[model samples]
Target chain A: MPDLAASSKRPPPWALRILVLTYLTIFLFAPLLALGVESFREGALSLWQGITEPESLLALRNSFLLAAIAVVLNVLFGIAAGLVIARQRFWGRALLDGLIEVPLALSPVMVGLAFILIFGRTGWLGPWLSQFGVRVIFSFPGLIIATLFVTVPFTAREVIHVLSEIGEEEEMAATTLGASRWQTFWHVTLPNMRGALSCGISLTAARALGEFGAVLIMGGAITGSTHTATTWIFTAVDERNNGAALGLSLVLGLCSVALLLLVEKLRARAHERR
Target chain B: MRPALTPTSRWSLLLRGAVIAWMLLLVVLPLVALAIHGLRSGVPFFWAAITEPQAKDAVALTLWTALLISLINAVLGTATAWLITRYRFRGRRLLATLIDLPLAIPTLVTGIMLVVLFGPMSPLGAWFEGHGIYVAFHSPIIVLALGFVTLPFSVRMVQPVLADMDRAEEEAAASLGASRLVTFLRIIWPSIGPAVLGGALQTFARAMAEFGSIVVVSGNVPHETLTAPVYIYGQVESGDSHGAAAVALALVTLSLLVTLFSKLMVRWGVRRHA
Candidate 1:
């Protein structure tokens, strides 16, 4: 409606198009190419073998276990939060929506530091939990907490937008027909968010697997126990084992790519549904 | 539609209240605690540490680096978003997914990816080092490397805005005899300007607090390359709890300001556009 755009334009001039393309190739593909090449180099096989060693495999196991646990937790809680914020016209709905993005904006290091102050030995709840002979810091539980804190919002934000668009009309109609509340939600609402849920979970899992800053602070990079894949990579680098670090990183990178791809595909499909 | 007065309202209200409560108590309260503890640890101690020439140097350096990284991403992220939204070239969808690679790739993995690609033995690393541009480690390469991770946020935030831009408006402008540059400047830029700035602010926020990726690549040299977050970690490890608290306070405040400012900017932008 603005007249400003009602001006003339050449068809994305050759120079401009070339400029954009050249910038894209340099900035986008260059660093990626560097990694893609090194990921399959001569020593990459030996590095792979090292990453599969028992200790290393344990790290990989810890990473997957943590991601699975966090993703499932976020999926349940995030969707619930999404539903409430999107459907309800509460006094603080806007506030709640904003709060959902807090973790996403926060740096991982800050999240880790917060976890320590709340759960570490000198932490607020640290003394409270110590009575139960439970250690919160330098433990696997701490790693999961760190991962969960940083990843909790991804699913919530994704699902909330989708739910808001899909709306309460369907649920209302189903309930009007004498469907049970739970039945209506399952039949009318759950089906509407399938792709969004998948994309959200994929992002959460991707984040959990790649968590390093929060995990490092919470677990002190402890190996074989609290060691996640990211922390393990850092430890390898600290020990000057670049190849081992590269091998672990390659696996993590691939997982991230796969999740991002899935999310992209779902986003495309979700747009069609809406 | 279903009747309004159902038990579903009660349960949904309860769930929503719980979420708001949880976020406030966990995320907001800790940030509050971080500030109070940071200040309570003593203004003298905080000033003493931060006022030292070296610490001041690190702070200034970090700010500039974050600014540079944010600026670079603002231009590049917007261009990339423009390309993805406007074009149907080969591999277009793939590029969209790949641009977000950093979001899911975990910051540490990103650092590791760079390490593999730029380490001395790798061809790419050797090429840079050979050219007297040693970007591998313990240099400004840390800023450049972390830049990759933060680029996705800016692009993701701006892309949708760009996509929403009415191409029909631009075409009309062209019909009226405006050049491409004129139309883009007067139309597209105005619509997306504040949004891009909002996204750039976010990029700046994340870059300022970036620790994991920078820590690995910067070598964490105390005066030369130690960012505030890394500095805090050192304090914790060295048992300088109060000093750590001080640094943490500053970091938290900076991010809090950026977040609040961006939110305001976004709202202002919306009102103006409306």
Candidate 2:
């Protein structure tokens, strides 16, 4: 630690510190504390009852299920995409690099709308797909697609960043030792990227778990069918079921905080290893 | 000279092609589809969708709140980043975790947090209502929600740059009898300026397209608090896909421009840092 205090030879600006504390408290912590209190106002039993309701339970289940599937898909795709971009010099690489961030830059709603335009009944491919009895929109498939779209870049970006930094020396050494390409990738590359991969997957899972706008638009938020925990919370609030809303919101918040903590841990561990 | 394709090279080629195709199908195709759908009805209808009074209000409110929130975020985020990067503080790790809460939590819950904190039912909310200061179902609440969602952007962006920055200049200034403020203004500001602006640009883009949190807080009041995303949502729900597409196109265009600008800034910052 550089002794900022000694260097300045002065006490810290207490006023500025207090201002930041006050601002964050008002904007972040206060709301969360209020949410906690409201969720528990009716006691733990009610909070339990709220999430245990069949619809809420189903919604929670769907959210977790979708997140799991999306995480798996994204990780696989991320590995392939990350390797291509990080290891290979190719034409249009810059364009592909730019495309990775397209999902992040656009609104979740816009992503959802794009799905609608691609997979909805009146969509370009929708009619053709429907001829074979395939349903994409207003279903689990829609939820998966939406979650995948929003989180598509997370794992890939992380892996690519890690791969680029670590370079290809280890893999080249392995290959020169007569190791097969797959052997080099698995033994040399995968181990090096494990920490970053986990961090990215966790981050993607967290984002997928909380996705709303795209899911709402693509899945249509149909209760007991396509409804996610987030969509359910939205409906609960809209229907004036504040108790249920607060309880579900608390549940979601807790899970997310836990996941974020995990991400931080993974990130710190990766940094130390690096 | 072009090398003949070996088995390993062929396999790698296949992998690259697969990843590229996957990305094209996942992001590029959907986006192209949206662009086509949005413009299918021609420019006159697109003009009409955007020129509607309600639509105009939504666009205006989105831009206004996004600007305010990004400015607030830039100043406060920079301060928070400075404190964390410069000082040895207790609970700094915990504070840093809290800053990333929004990224992990479902954004919809952000709105619920605000509602529970400032809704008419809570004590504080009731008191505010008694004093005729409304929060929920209003525009300021939208700004607050956006601020919460984007709070981490600038801080996260600047922290690494600040951490890696040479403190020798500041120490030299201090040794030369320069005030702390002068040291910061003369040495620190220029170093972190590009990063803060880059992060602020991304934050602004995020705020403009923010939906889940704002929807829950803003009450979607027509011509008052409804943002472009929510308005697009309403248009979609009402079976007005064209109208939704028009607004979505506008928001996407704005976000892409901001994202491109931010990317340029990132390049500039990296170059300058080097």
Candidate 3:
């Protein structure tokens, strides 16, 4: 590839570099640093106090638990969705393709509201389900469902991309060797999609960890019951417990940064392999 | 092609049906429920729900912030992408990773980061307040927070295109004495135009649907800072399910349109280039 910069002899590289770095510093790094300082402003003991507080710990635990649940569910459903979408030819396939992306674009709050409209007391499924003493909204199930809804596309999209690129040749070969569909999928397709599937899981888990709007709406932000870490931070902020809020944010931020680095590594590995 | 009813084909069909059923139960049904519930009170109620002063302001704020973020992100994101792709420099990898940082961080933490940095209690925030400017609980803060959340979309979207693009046209144009800006405008802009547009639209949709970060930063002040998603959440919390659903549906519909539009644009661009 020709070097556009070397050939064009554009303005000094430093100018553009400085501009880009300055923008990022002002917008991205600065706020994060500020939070870092605030979180530890009162030193290690205070940070520990904030994090080890029962409510904070429970919220953190809930966030991980809910995210893990969503990740497991997404892995199962997402692979199936990815396989069918990538490999199949059928009517209305394009419509499904479009619809699957809806969650990414739609508001999480709306996603939660949609579930409530179906599962809330006055909802279509509420009365029927209530007869069986089943509850969804304002519960852990609701939190998982909302997180699942918001994160539905990540794994499926990643797997679809990987599958599309890997194509159907190997699966066809396996089938021609008299392998059943299940065996072919498990042996041939799944191995090929492992990288993307893992990446998708990481992405899904990270997103679910950070999810707020949908969970807050669906789970109703009931402390010690439905409140995830993000909601707890919000509550901390609301109650003017800035130290606790900032501390929780610091922990979540670090975890996510680790996840981001993992994603970056995966992306780099994928590109290198490609 | 002839439709086959062989056992293998039947099994494949069953798998496909299973995926479809899962999607219907999880994705489609809830959306349909939301639509039905939102409109259950008829045209007048839906109209009133969306047109209430707070609802109207929320909608307006959502659009205004989304548009502002799109424009800002387009310029900065494109520049960042350009810098990274065209010019290799020290810390390029680190810069790229940092750019993707917001993606991994929970967005509610993003709001908290802003508060830690710029809330009234902080020294910098206090200085800004003294100057009659504010970051938290302001419309501009919403734009800023959403900008951070949506930061990676345009750059990530456009980066791959630039990497794969043939730089010969740019080199040739520059060799012909075309100025840097003119050469970029003439040669580069046309190539990446659709990509930037698509990314910008996606960014806009993301900003529009942003709830978690906005809720934390906006202080949820009615009519003043409450965004559409936050407003819907507030409505639900306030026991106005119909109103929340109506607004949620409107936001969902708008986002779906934008997302689909961006998808169409990308497809068209690919076909055009092909």
Candidate 4:
């Protein structure tokens, strides 16, 4: 009411507000509301028990391990690519930058299939590696490989964009001022990259937790072994065990929301800095 | 006095090289293997693999479903971004987050959410079934699942551009006797086209790649429903890696084409803006 007169200059029609509210309620809120309501319908304690159940725990454990491995791999990639694209004058830097986004635009199942076609027992590498008795598809190695494939660019993309904007003048100046390149990087570049690195890691971690298609296809969804939280949730829902599935989903949902918030904050700050 | 370049500089240079190597190892190599596998299997075999009456049907279904999702999301996403940016309303942040929630939620959970919202027992599900508009576990229903996850791309891509738009131009157009619709067409639209188109491509790519959610909802019938990704998975599981590679190659080619298309759109937008 206080700003009503101020809004006299540009008040969107009330109809617009009403329409937007109604649209979201139907398209976005309604279904998720169903999941949330049905899950807690039996009270939180039972849901908590479902979350702690051995099968649920095993799924959580497997997903966590898989996500951790994937994130570690991607972070190393992110730091490396971020460094090169930020500082190097390479012949193919532009092409490499373009290449980083290929995964984001590809289908997850296609990604899964790509992994299987390359690492499955009869795949090009699969047979050669099989000679060494290394199994990829339907194993932890497959899960990590697939997850890494999807996750590689998230951090690098984030870090590169950040690093690109932060010019090399500072690093070069520091290096010329007697600091070793390593020291200059650690003290200058690393500190500036802290926010991007954090954001990138969070994204990788969040996606790792939620990965399903690749893990399901390559990892085989064996109980207590290869089943990720997403796969476990899928199985539970399919088996008509809504209670346990919702409980498991809630856990992963919370992690995703948290990581996304961090990403949003970092990206917003970056945008504002511009 | 110039600070002496130390071993640190060389080491960091090597690190950058390693990063480039890593990108090749992680991204390029797997794809190369897939491509080589496709080649080894020969075009005759791939033609056989894909044209295996049912297999051809699967690829067609996947493309059409993805295309449908992209078309629907393009309209809805534009409407959403228009509302979110052009108006300041209650629950706007919640609306924004809800749209993007698909990006963060595990796709399998997305499937479960759809099932609960429209499965046999739910009120809407019952109504839809009663009206002979069964949405659960159906072909058209797959578009809905694809659209659910791809919805975020359009809005995110558009909102930032809209927020950055010059409203004075719109006002000037209106004062010059252009109706709101005409003003939007002449002024705002030219600016947002590339973004909307790029978003559409991303959605199409995502929809085609859909696995976790679609698999859950589609019931994965052979030619009637199985997507190319799922079809590839089936081949690999059946110990036919060569057949899988053939299909995987087709999927990868589609991805490359779509990505090039998106790049073209974004580049055109940049040039237009310039």
Candidate 5:
């Protein structure tokens, strides 16, 4: 391959490489660096105080709780729907597949709006739910729903891709060996799906954690009660409390980067297994 | 012939029903409710709501900015992908990882990072302002934020196509005295064109619905900087659910169209490959 490439394709010009690097620096790297610098500029004490404040801590906790719930729900849906789509012949199969991608295309704000229309004060279900003393919008449940909606595609798509690639041979063999359907799934299909499953989970977690717009609207950005880290950052910035905003931004940013690294590792492992 | 992975037992039937129900409740029903609510005030009222000057400007700004960003990503992402695939350089892995960073980071943090780097208080931002080029809290920042969040779409879309691409044709073209640009246009472009287009369209769809980062970075100034999603947020916040839903519906419709077209492009590409 190296010989073929050397004989056929010349290295691209330095100018193009420089241009690409410069663009990335301005667009991605420099901004991230700026965040790190600004966060620490006020010294470690201020940064610590900013993040450890009651509101900021609550925001972080809320974000993590929502992300955890979203991850679990998405994984469940991913596996079930992935199996149905990949292994079963069903009515509306194509429609289900298409609908899975809808969340990806719709803006997060639209998602929040969609939920509010279904659960807000004058919404279809709002009055009924209120009668039961249950709140959906402007609460944690709303945050979870919106996060779940946006992160839905990641896991299911990954599972579907893995299932198609792995095929049904193992499961069919298991059945021929007198294994029940559940047994075949648990012993054969699930084991084979492990790598892809983890990959999907990581993707889901990252997306759920980073979710902002939908969560913001659904949670109503109320300080201690409904605010997630993302929303809190918005509020902090709005109030000119750059310290708190930068502190939380750094924390979330680092968490995202860590998740991204894990995803890359999982992806590489999946490729190796393939 | 392949056997069924799971025969239609009672268990399988139950699982399928549960999965379908879950999807309906989690994804489809809310969207249906949104559509109904958006149009509940009648077509004329919905039309008037969306056509209001502020709403119109927001939608227009979102579309225009999304279009511009998609075009830019198509070009730059291609270049970046080409560099990654064709070169064996130092920090190549780092560059690839950085490309995926936007996907991992919470977009609200992405906005904050941009603000930290280019807000009026920052040295770089102050320098730019001295020359009358306002980046933070201005229209230009919208491009940067959208570009940051949507960074990986085209590059990831194009990377695999480039990697799997056969070099034989290019070698032949080069041996036949074809220029690098000519070879690319004739041989490589034809193969990767659909992927690039699909990626760009996906970027456009995603950007149109982007909110979190833009909300913070663009400052959401009514007629000047507000994008559709942010405008919808405002409408919802200001106690105008119907108007918000109306605008949300329009954005959703446009996104659905773009997503379908992109999926079609992918299918067409696969057919051509097969």
Candidate 6:
């Protein structure tokens, strides 16, 4: 790739480069810089104090808890679904693949609404679930489900891409040598796609942590109990508490930057291995 | 292709069944619930719900803004992709990394970032407001937030295609006395066109559904800056489940159509390359 660039006789037009850079500066970098500047505008001590308030702390904790649970569930489901789609041919396989991507395209608001239609007081499952004394909406379970819906495609999509590229020859060989299906999966397939899985996991974690719209609708963003970091930021902004909003935004922004860096490193390593 | 590697065994059957059941519960059930709930009051009520003045305005605003954002992204994203793939320069890696930042960042933070930069309270925002130009809490902020959140789509989509392109044809055209512009239009655009279009459609679908960032950035004035997702959120909050579901179902249907077309474009691109 480097050689190809070097071999080219002409450098790209400078105007195009400047245009792109200017766009990035105004649209992306400037806003990010503003976030950092404003977060500490009140000084570091105040920023720290704002983020450490009981509500903020609980919101952050809830975000982490939801993200953790979403990651585990999505990873397990992603692996199983990815394996099925890649390793077997069956009726509705293509349909299933397309369906998996539905969450990505659907509005998060719609996702919340859909669940409410199923679990809200007047919903189809409401009466049956009430008989069991179970509440789903406006609760932790609803928040986790909404996160899961949004993050569902990441791991499975990554796993499918890797599996398709690596092929089934290794698994076939293992099976031919008398390895059980589980053994072959554990020893062969899992080892080969570790990088892709991690990439997917990081993506899921980032998305789950950052989820807001669906969680807000589903969990009701009740101040202390239901507010994730994002909903907390929204409420903070609504209450004209710019200090807390900016402070928490800065923290989430930094976490996402770290996650983005991790994804890039993983992608680079995966490319090198290929 | 090769004789089935592992014949369907009882364990394999169980795995497939379990995966399918999980998908049904997680993915299909909610969609069905939503559809049923949306239509429960009959088509007239559903129609009236979505056609209400505020709902109509919200959907229109979302569509137009998303369209504008996608068009801008198409040009800028392709330019960025081309620069990164064809040029050797300092900070190129950093630029590439920054392109993906929007995806990794909590979108609510993205809104806060913009608000800090241009909200009415900030100096820049106050300056704009003094001139009667609203950046945050208006239609423009919707564009910025959507643009920020959807920035990476086209660039990421086009980058790989550009990198993997066989430069032989381009070089041949260059050596034959074709100007760079002529060569690009004749040789390069044909291959990347489908990818760019696919990416743009995906961006449009994504932008239409964006909620977290826009809700924070746009003040959500009904019949003014309110977007479809935010409007839906409002309905949900007000206990108007039927209205929310009807409008949500409309948004989902449109997004699904756009997504299906995007997939077709991608498949067409792959076939062309093959």
The DockQ leader among the candidates is 5
Query: Could you give candidate 6's fraction of true interface contacts?
Result: 0.63
lDDT of 2 by residue, A1-274 (tens): 2223322333347977897898788778887787777766768887787888898999999999998998888888888877888888878987998898899988888888888888888888899999999989998888888898899889999998998899877777787788877788788888888887898888998898889999999988897799999999999887977667877888888888988899888877776665
Model 2: lDDT to the true structure: 0.85
Tens-place lDDT per residue, model 2, B1-274, is 1212222487778978888888898889888877787788999888888889999999999999998888888888888887777776677778888988878888899988898788777788789889888888887789889988888898888888888888788889999999989998889888888998999998999998899998888889899988999998888888888788888887898899998998899789888989
The DockQ scores of all candidates, in the order shown, are: 0.45, 0.53, 0.54, 0.43, 0.60, 0.59
Model 5 lDDT per residue over B163-260, tens place? 87888899999999999899989999988999999999999999998888888888889999999999999888898988988898888888999999
Scored against the true structure, residue A214 in model 4 reaches a CA lDDT of 74
- Error (Å) of candidate 4 at residue B225 is 2.9
Better of 4 and 6 by lDDT: 6
- In order of TM-score, best first, we have 5, 6, 2, 3, 4, 1
Q: In candidate 3, how many Å is residue B25 off?
A: 1.3
Per-candidate RMSD vs. true structure? 3.5, 2.5, 2.7, 3.3, 2.1, 2.0
Please tell me how candidate 6 rates in CAPRI terms: medium
Residue B85's lDDT within candidate 4 is 77
Q: What is the lDDT of residue A163 in candidate 1?
A: 85
lDDT per residue, candidate 1, A85-127, as tens digits?
8777767778778777777666676677767777778878889
lDDT of 4 by residue, A1-274 (tens): 1112222234567766566556555556776787787676747987788788898888888888878887777777887788777767667879888888877766666677677767776566889999899998887888888788888878898889888888777877897778876687789888878778888888888878878877888888887777778888888877877667888877887788877877777767766666
Q: lDDT per residue, candidate 6, A16-76, as tens digits?
A: 8898988788778888888878766778887787799899999999999988998898888
Tell me how candidate 5 scores on lDDT. Answer: 0.86
Docking class of 3: medium
Winner on TM-score between 1 and 2 is: 2
What does candidate 5's lDDT look like per residue over A1-274, in tens digits?
2122422245667987998988788778898888878877867777788899999999989988888887888788888877888888878889988888788888888888889888899888999999999998888888888888889899899898889889888888878888876788888888877777788888888888788888888889886699988889889988988678888888888888888899889888777666
Error of 6 at A255 (Å): 1.3
Reference-based TM-score, model 6: 0.96
Indicate the residue-level lDDT of A101 in model 5: 79
Better of 3 and 6 by lDDT: 6
Superposed model 3: Cα runs more than 4 Å off: A1-12, B1-8
By lDDT, rank the candidates, best first: 6, 5, 2, 3, 4, 1
Among the numbered candidates, top lDDT falls to 6
Model 2: CA > 4 A from native: A1-11, B1-8, B177-182
For B101-173, candidate 4 gives per-residue lDDT tens digits of: 8778777777777777787888988998999997887786687677777878888877777777767888899
Docking class of 4: acceptable
Residue B75, model 5: lDDT of 92
